[model samples]
Target: MRHIKEYDGLRGLMALWVLVGHWAATIYIQFPWPANLGNAYAVDVFVILSGFAIATLVERKRETYGIYITRRVLRIFPVYWFYLAISIALAWVSVDMWTNAAGGEATSNRLQISIAALDNFWPNVISHVVALHGAVPRNMVPNGEYAFLGQAWSISLEWQFYLIAPLVIALGVRAASSFKAGLVLVLGLFVLSYISPRFPYSFIGRYSAFFAIGIATYFLVNVGIPFLTQRRIVIAPIAMLIVTALILLQLPSVLPVSIWIVATASVLVPSQFGLSAIAGLLRWKPVQALGQMSYSVYLSHMAVLVLAMLVLEKAGITSTYLHAALLLIITLAGTLIISIASYNFIEVPFQRLGRNLATRPQAAE
Candidate 1:
């Protein structure tokens, strides 16, 4: 039940990776480092961590499904709704500018996301309100998942997982054997994957494997395999090296996924001698602070970037390098201020409120 401070730092780092990647891509800047441009991979890491963190919560805390869901709603929705309001406002004001931004191909994708955010405005609002935007396919509703807040597609995905996590945890607990449970879980995920083509690409089924890795890790580190503890320090670097090699080779899909599982599991290993070094870096103060407000940073950065780009374009910043430099500085400054304020005002208070509401006793009949 103890909070893992290192996870916060990891989340912070992932948020920055996504922010910087998007910023760079929008400006057509390619970093020399492969992972530096890996926005999608960073998102996968978020899903893995979400699974790990949520599993830890459900396994340790005894609560009715109603209370559990209530807490989750308050945790996610308050900050999300705040950002949704901002997205809506900006969509009305600057959708046209983004739609017509220069750097033609370089800015097209960002423009598409911004334009779609308001394309079928009402329907997008409704889908986002229910947090089922991720389950709605593009054919049925074009870009519905990313319609309101582009990055919020994953927020809806995480919400869907929160709804089912208790049942998943219960099933895992009842199975009583980690191996048997894992076998069944893998089979179920395979079935889900088989049928996934019939569903939305953004549906939880497509990403459930990452979550399974996290849940499996929870048991491995906490309950199932204590013997692996000392060896994890050695395993961590080996896993990283394999991930790097796989990246270099661009091997089969499953190989990378397998190595990612090892890498993620190693990062979650408890702090000890060699492992503590990794933990120490992850727990650095600035990174930890960034982690504290990471949700706000991730959700709000796009709006900041888009709006800043609009301003710069209108101001006739013609030089590509100059434009990118100015945009980066403005976006970072704006995102940091907004993230800090929102984390303190919106996330913390609503979380406290959710806890109070969830803990209140039901009246007797």
Candidate 2:
């Protein structure tokens, strides 16, 4: 349960990949890298990280269910509410800009999510908290001018998943000693991961693999199941390779889903060194540092793309290559600077608050 440096490296890499994906979307399309590795494809890494971290923390609390739930809520909600407030503010500004352009006010067909409804922002906020936006259609209407509003979809999904995760882990912990029960849960999650994509607006679609992968990975790593732990190193690289191939090949239509699930499953391999072969490669310090800042990179990458666009627009540079390079520079630089601030100012404080509150003493014995 101690932090894995190699996983941190993967975090950094995945964040970078996601940044590139978004850059490709919001800025220039002339980049040399594959575009198929969009936010949906790469952000699962975040989900997996969440699953891993969450399970590690909560599994230890098998004796204290209330404490477990309280700890989780404390860990998750503070940072989330802060982020949601920021998102709402950003949304307000975006909506403001679009509605009152120089050409005068432009009205939106969907004003349910408007500032007028700001008093009742709880519904939209709760939907985001519950990851039900995609599940329930037209709940949060897109602001025509602000582009990153779509990306909030991931935040909503993460929040929703976090809510159920404790119960899921509670079940998993109960079923842990029973290999058959754990195995059944794994199978059910796997099935959901595969079939949810077809659910037509289900929040479970596509991203459910992340939860499955994380939960399955825990059992694979810790449960002493001979079949799973034996070939972990081999599994890691092979799965990593498969994920890479899928990304490079731009395999749409659930190919990414397939590779990700396989890759996630590979995380279960015992210590047979399946992925350990690449450990040397993934263990470099810089890579781990990158992973630590992955969240900052992700949150700020879109802003980087926007800045890159503005620069290019002002300079009248039309080529994709130039734009991509600028984006890379801006993203890396912005990621570093902003992540430092975000980690210190945003992420770390709430993390301490969560930990302190969870560990605090009760009022009167």
Candidate 3:
């Protein structure tokens, strides 16, 4: 399938946004306006983009299920497993530190360490190991560290989507002949979202609407939407405005996820209209490079932030603003460096392997 550089840029921007959001939450650094938008919103963008990317791939390549699955596994698992190992090691050290720091004194750290290991650690580990944590309620450790990879909950959700995408694509393809059938499918997804609140950790139920929006966008783009086909100057500003609104409002609880879905679609669909000046910005070499390493950045940034915080505390950095700034700088710089290495060493090799295996005639079968 052909590459979509603009989408790559979007992924890079979203990854950076997630890093910023984590910094805000972890260190209490409040940024002004657009920067303050919740990272959860960025995650929704990721979910939508994932659906779009997968749909586009299936539509364009028409690859066999085996090949599709292999491609996805290679794209996701190598970096994921690498980061998981690091997180596990970090958790081990954290537990030891907490135990030592307690030194017969009552401390939350000791309690957290005990709860993480004794109560929730094994189960959480099993869930995360199998990539089913997104579907399993009560998978989180008591201290909300999420067993050392708190951000991985979304990765788990993405894994679930990857597993089922072939079926979703098949269904979509089958329904293409009948608009009524497609509408029914879309409605079903909405119904799932409507009931998602009743089921904790129901990634599908909670995010299916966004994914549906993405799939719908793919179809719309394939067929050509006139409004989106407008000039980039017009579309780009509107998309930016939607994003800015999303940021400013912080999305009141009363608003449904569909609003964000629409906003995400607004941003993504227009960029595909045609390569314009705006697209040029997104396709800049550095931006595309960042996008290429986005997966690694996403998986590794939280761990980097946590480790940095621990080191900062050890160094007696008590100012919140200073801590926040230092954490941001360290996390961004460290994550970029680590991601660059990971992309070169882990991601590219596995990707090439997956491609080689998928292209083999017998493997495709």
Candidate 4:
């Protein structure tokens, strides 16, 4: 638990990657940088990190199940509910205006906002709240000017992944004796995710392959990849952050393909049995910090964008580009502040609640 602080860096960094992906996409509407960097894979990276982190947190081999679930709830739900508070409240206030912005849909109806009609709201509240929309055909990401609201879809996916992955992990512990069991479980989940379109494993499929990668990575890292643990290796999420920035931001001219490619590469690159520079970067400091609050950053970023745009609109500026640029600045600043603050207040507190509330010590855990 004490060393978990080290993982915090990855969480913040991955979360930031997600934020950058979102911000990049928003800018792409005006700037056109490589064009493929905007998919939810950066969020996928975050999911991987979440799975990796939770694997460490709840492994029955490592800790008791009751303490594990309680700790997980404390870690995941409070800030989640708090952010939901932020989203619901912001959604409430902006509903009319946002509805007006949508123009094609009913503007003032709570039913519309709450219901989130497929054609109009994209999976509505039920799927959104439960993180099930990705299982079906609904576009989990937003379309065009509708970008801000779509960010929540990843949160939904993350939430659902959190719920189901533990069960899969626990199964591995019961079914097998070693990390090999975990690998089978993770690969099985990956196979499930790969075939999700046909079978519909959970509420969504965006996280299928990504979550599996995280699980596998956990085994590889924590259990040591055959001989790697003998050498005491690590991923360095902060380094990943820096490399991600350089490749995605500083040198896109030199760096072609897309963030989508990069994200997939993030997963695949690790599997290569050689020296890993990018993985080392992912384990970097600044990158790690962004990864830590990445969850809060993902969940709350859209609201920040929406709020920023609204503020810009009220400030008498209506140009889409200007609004977007201003929105980016404001949203980035606001999202970072909120993410850090929430991590400290809501996220940290709740994530730690189980520690304080636990009936036993290490034994309870």
Best candidate according to lDDT: 1
TM-score ranking, high to low: 1, 3, 2, 4
Model 4 misplaced stretches (Cα beyond 4 Å): 1-10, 24-36, 92-149, 173-195, 198-206, 224-285, 318-321, 358-365
TM-score of every candidate relative to the true structure: 0.85, 0.67, 0.77, 0.65
Candidate 3 lDDT by residue in tens digits, 1-365 = 24667778878878888888766655544456443356777777788788888888788767788788889888898898899878877876665544443121222443374356445767777777776766764434443325567677788778888888767766787787978767866877777777766544536777776676677767766654555566334444564465567677885421324333333343455344353555666678998899889999999997787677678768887777777789789998999999999999999999999878767875567
The weakest ten consecutive residues by lDDT in model 2 span 101-110
Residue ranges of candidate 2 with Cα displaced over 4 Å: 30-39, 63-135, 138-148, 173-202, 225-277, 315-320, 362-365
Q: By lDDT, is 1 or 4 better? A: 1
lDDT tens digits, residue span 199-231, model 2: 433365456656766776666566634564465
lDDT of 1: 0.77
Q: Give the Å shift of residue 363 in candidate 3.
A: 11
In model 4, the worst 10-residue window by lDDT is 102-111
Ranked candidates, highest lDDT first:
1, 3, 2, 4
What TM-score would you give candidate 4 relative to the actual structure? 0.65
Instruction: Provide the clash count, candidate 2.
Output: 15
6-29 per-residue lDDT for model 1 (tens digits): 778878988998898878777745
Number of the predicted model whose TM-score against the real structure is largest: 1
The local distance difference test score of each candidate is 0.77, 0.57, 0.70, 0.56
**At residue 307, what lDDT does model 1 achieve?**
85
